[model samples]
Target: MDFEQGSINISDEVLKEIAFRSFLEVLELSADDKDAKKLKKNIEIERTPDDNVIVNVKTVAPYGKSLVEFGKKIMQNISENIQRMTELQVSAVNVSIIDVVEKIEPAEEEE
Candidate 1:
């Protein structure tokens, strides 16, 4: 008699969590902050029956020239990182600009 063990199965949820954590590391985000962590963030991941992965990421950025450049840089970095790190074929990484954050003004101190 011969017996064979089944291969390990990886769930999509697990993959998404892994991807999200990786995103944080690549983006240099504060992973220590539970609220700031991508995995814990409002991002959503969907997997098609054909094994294609789709991710929609919503991020807030301050309105400025540098911030615009940084946002673009972040998007590129995310695409590259996902491809390099995951075995699952990524169908697309869609970024939606839902909100713009204004720069915070420093409060004046009274002597």
Candidate 2:
């Protein structure tokens, strides 16, 4: 975007962060969760020639979840959040389900 004095720019790292957070939100996961921390490393953002962005995300879906519906949710959430927050166009959001795992419950703490 342009202004009288200068132009505003959003960095790639910022875009990636937005995408990662949106992914976690869709899964109802907290940022401090170990899974979320690992998932953060799997997000990538690429800028197009026209200043738009393409987001690629790799994740493991929880078993028994419908993969198609889950992927659609991730795409929609990431795209909307990025566009709403940065005012930048998202050309595409590509999601790759790398694996599927059963939900693991944390062990009860022993006092």
Candidate 3:
């Protein structure tokens, strides 16, 4: 799933969908991050001259293990999503975690 060229041309619509989907998936994985509890978020994508698509995902994670898990999810989702649109080999999916979300509060339970 490597885009040897470094970047691939995709429709604006596809890009938008990818961004949105990627963001949501990240959000779900980082649900425990208190800082990430903020409903508002954004994701940015850029194509490098070499043909590599750089996905800058801004979100929060529960730290440590959760962070790693979120990263794996990002790669899988992006790779699978791109494949669904076209058979282009994506050189790489670069994900940058911009914000570290605050820890989430545990839910209360009744006896």
Candidate 4:
């Protein structure tokens, strides 16, 4: 998708939220920083005057997963969604792995 004349302007925070939510749908992962302030540092959005945006996402993936393929999926998902929603071309989407988290099992109730 593409836009001309710059009729619309979107906030960086909104882009970040879009990215964060998109990532969650693509994979089983968690962001390193849960707080809004810290999250800002993890997700970066660079917007060009031409309506092209570059997104950077840092996250903790589920253990035992392939980082390379995982990152690719994240980038593809974010880029596609952004273009579909805002009609803005995503110049690039970068994914950074901060750490990997183990899946915790729930305890069984007494029978």
Name the best candidate (by TM-score).
2
Q: For model 4, what is the alpha-carbon lDDT of residue 88?
A: 76
**Cα deviation of 67, candidate 4, in Å:** 1.0
lDDT at residue 43 of model 2 (Cα atoms): 87
lDDT of 4 by residue, 1-109 (tens): 2258555667877888788767766753354424323444466899878768999887666678787988899899999998888777899998877676674111110
Residue-level lDDT of model 3, residues 46-100, one tens digit each, is 6667655555554445554567777778777876776566664455565555445
Better of 1 and 2 by lDDT: 2
TM-score each candidate: 0.62, 0.87, 0.53, 0.70
Stretches of candidate 2 above 4 Å error?
104-111
Report the lDDT tens digits of candidate 1 across residue range 1-111: 112865554566665665566556544566575445433454567877876677766655456646566556645655566556665667777665555556421111000
lDDT of 3 at 50: 64
Total clashes in model 3, counting residue pairs 3 or more apart in sequence or in different chains: 20
Q: Kindly state the number of residue pairs that clash in model 2.
A: 0
Between 1 and 3, whose lDDT is larger?
1
Between 2 and 4, whose TM-score is larger?
2
How much does candidate 1 score in TM-score? 0.62
Tell me the lDDT of candidate 2. Answer: 0.83
Order of models, best lDDT first:
2, 4, 1, 3
Candidate 3 wrong stretches, greater than 4 Å = 1-9, 29-41, 48-52, 63-65, 102-111
Model 3, position 53, has a per-residue lDDT of 58
